[model samples]
Target: MNKKVFISGSISIKKLPKEAQKSIDNIINKNFEILVGDAKGVDSLVQRYCASRGYYNVKVYSIYDAPRNKISDKFRFEKVEVSESVRRKRESERQQAKDQAMTRDCDYCLVIWNGRSKGSYANILRAKELKKGLKVVINN
Candidate 1:
């Protein structure tokens, strides 16, 4: 079976350079099921691209419900939302569940950021700890 790949990156998709988009395309052509956070930026683009190509294997695991934007809603990717409570204990548990799901579902992870944000960095670290392969794509 082809490995499933998780995509972690900046939410600012509009800011991505042309070269970065090319790289993402190349990665997607590898036939791995793409998993993304679908928050914004690279994740949103990846999901949209996959959906447009009729790639039903693509999925998005989000921390919250879908954004109110039409672009986010247009993508036909499967989305799983994790609940976040005001309570620290509940939030921690929710985050842990997300991490666990990511580890189990992803065989590899691709990070597309010049520098790491909290969520992207944590995802990379978790992938590493779980011994999943890692790929980093940078915009120039």
Candidate 2:
């Protein structure tokens, strides 16, 4: 079966882990459909590397019409609807809703976190709440 790997992370990480690169690369090479949020940091890095390598089975999930990162024009997207309440809230709240939506349809989630990012921690817990497979890689 084609695995749908959900990717989430902190916005402050400077480098992608080697293990992450290997796992993502393998997913791309094997043609697994990728589901990722359209935030900065880890999301951007993953999208950039995948686009550079011509990996096409990617679906960028976002709350706004446009993603925060520079997502490639070659990929498809899944936009999450922002509620009126969330519209009244902060950007992080809107982003968290998007992450929850993406996680709902994924088979497994790979989180690259620094252990202190609220967004990353929220996504990790959200995955567990939905009973989805969770794999966290603590980034330095």
Candidate 3:
């Protein structure tokens, strides 16, 4: 089976830096599967780039029943299930459900941080805690 990489980043990052693109290119060249979230900023940019490159081995994870933004409908959609308590929580808290699931499922992780996004930092910490090989690109 192909390796799976979780690509996550700060919601504040609206563009991909050269380093981030290079990391993505490496993953694509290796034909690894990609797991990404459904959010604006970096997530949307990544989705668009992957679609432009014709890389379809992607799964967009969401906490809701459907993704808010999926650049390529051909990519698979995964709705992570959380408990009622989590569902009732704040938006970021609820979103963590999907992030945790992706962290658990991926063999590797690529995070593009804008230097101050708590969510991106959390993903990095979670990946380290889970012992997944992780590369972080600081965009700021």
Candidate 4:
């Protein structure tokens, strides 16, 4: 089976830096299956890049049944089911469930942080706590 990589970053990042693009290119070259979120910012940019390249080995993990932004219909959708209590929490808390699910499912992870996003930092910490292999790129 192809290795699965969770590529994620801060929602505050409006652009994908050269480093991030290069990292993604390396992943694509290795034919890793990508597990990503369905959000604005980095997620959207990542989706667009992969779609532009016609890379269809991507799965958009989301808290809802349908993702908010899936750049291509070719990508699969993975809905991580959370408890009712979690669904009632703040949006960030709810989104974290999907992030955790992606972290659990990935063989490797690439986190692009903008230095101040608590959510992105949380993902980095979660990957560490789970002892998953990961790379972090500080975009800020």
Say which candidate scores most in TM-score: 3
How much lDDT does each candidate structure score?
0.62, 0.85, 0.94, 0.93
User: Alpha carbon lDDT of residue 68, candidate 1?
Assistant: 26
Summarize candidate 1's per-residue lDDT along 10-116 as a digit string, tens digits: 66545656665565576667877766663557766766666666555666675455532224443344444554452245643454455457666888877776574
In the range 1-140, model 4's lDDT, one tens digit per residue, is 88999999998898889888998999999999999999999999999999998899999999887899999999999989999999899999999999999999998889999999998999999999998889999988
After TM-score superposition, the amount by which residue 73's alpha carbon in candidate 4 deviates from its true location, in angstroms, is 0.5
Off by over 4 Å in 1: 52-54, 63-100
The order of the candidates by lDDT, greatest first, is: 3, 4, 2, 1
For residue 105, what is the lDDT in candidate 1? 85
Superposed model 3: Cα runs more than 4 Å off: none
> Tens-digit lDDT track for model 2 on 86-105?
88888887788888888888
Range of the 10 consecutive residues with the lowest summed lDDT in candidate 1? 67-76
lDDT winner between 2 and 3, please give it.
3
Task: Give Cα distance to truth, residue 43, candidate 2, Å.
Answer: 0.9
Q: Which pairs clash (backbone N, Cα, C closer than 3 Å) in model 3?
A: none
Which predicted model would earn the best lDDT? 3
Give the poorly placed runs of model 4, Cα more than 4 Å off.
Answer: none
